[model samples]
Target: MMDLLRSLLFVLLFYPGTLLYVLTVIIVSPIGDAPVQAVVHAWSQFHHWLVRNVLGIRIVWDGAIPDGPFLIAVKHQSMMEAVDTLHFAQCPVVVMKRELTVIPLFGWVTRRYGVIGVDREAGASALRTMMAEARAAVSGGRPVIIFPEGTRVPYGTSPPLRPGFAGLYRALGLPVVPVAHDVGRLWHRGFVKRSGTVHFKVGDVIPPGLKRDDVESRVHAAINALTP
Candidate 1:
């Protein structure tokens, strides 16, 4: 119950600030002066700070960003993990569910920035679309982030990752950075509250020159190798 109350309090502060940010995005992105992508990316960073502060999550930066464009396959623990990426990476155009675009202002913001949507039910067509987007993002000097598990899994328990992850790595042909961490305990589910540090450890990058068609097994192995 205390966590719920805290979350509500946080929401109160966040909503008003978010509204202001949304308005700024509208003003800046519409005019010719500011590039839409840069403005939105800035907003994402600020938004990350807002949530981190409200939730009392102190983000510790460790490791280095790969020298070239790469693919970032991260373990999804909570919504915070998704938001935190904006701070560390301007690259890694995130791959997310298509339905997120349906959200009001936030959806518009994500689209204007760097998120790529994939329809879960579209099967082969979705795979094709993901390949194209992932490849383009990597080729254009942005790392592409894929949640191999497809959805957020609470801490300590593993969710079986989807098979498409391998295909994405193969199709993109870039270094793969495997990110893993336990953030679920920080942002617990249901009607309670707790606050703590969330450590996101970014592991080594898988370099190019692997068998092109063998993307699936390689992606699965690398993700599994990430220490919990």
Candidate 2:
């Protein structure tokens, strides 16, 4: 019961407090995309403080965030992975669900910061459009981050990734950095939070070749290999 109460307190207090702390970020974020991006990055770091103190979750990185301007395939677990990525990489262009683009404050800010949205239901055609946008974003000097799994999965359960990652891989034709992590262990929905460490493993960048048009399976394998 104490654990549950603490968990509830952590969840309820964090959001409003976070917004209050970064009110300036929300207001000035609209000044320009880069300024907004910079604030969001700074906010993510601040967010780490909230998560660390309130939820008592620790994040530890075993490898390195590769040099930017490449399409990086990341395995998304729970919500923590989404929030934590800000501290892990140079503000890469995030591949997010189309629905998220409609949110009030975050949506507007993310759009300003150049997030690429995808409608998963539109199938292959949607993926092509997203890839094109990703290419343009990369050219603008930002790396693209995709959760190859396409959706969040529960701890220890692997969900099949949408094939969009393969399409992106071939279309972009840049080096791909595969990132894996143990985020769900500490941050899964309904799980009581306590003091613990989350491990993130950044693997070598897999440079592309002309003959291949798919790398989803390889990316999945690489990420899963890092799981405990």
Taken over the whole model, the C-alpha lDDT of each candidate is 0.70, 0.75
Tens digit per residue, CA lDDT, model 1, 1-228: 555666777777667876777677767776642366666566567667655666666766457656557778887867667766664565448989888866888788767665788888999899898898777677677778889888777777666667567678767766777777767767756534366676666776767667644554455555554335
Runs of candidate 1 exceeding 4 Å displacement: 1-5, 32-34, 191-193, 209-228
Give the poorly placed runs of model 2, Cα more than 4 Å off.
Answer: 18-26, 210-214
Candidate 1 backbone collisions, by pair: 3-192, 3-193, 92-143, 166-216
- Model 2: which ten-residue window has the lowest total lDDT? 209-218
Return the TM-score for each candidate structure: 0.84, 0.88
Name the lDDT value of residue 217 in candidate 2.
Answer: 60
Who wins the lDDT comparison? 2
Q: After superposition, how far is residue 69 of candidate 2 from its true place, in Å?
A: 1.8
Positional deviation of residue 43's Cα in model 1 after best superposition, in angstroms = 2.9
Worst 10 residues of 1 by lDDT: 219-228
| Best of the candidates, TM-score | 2
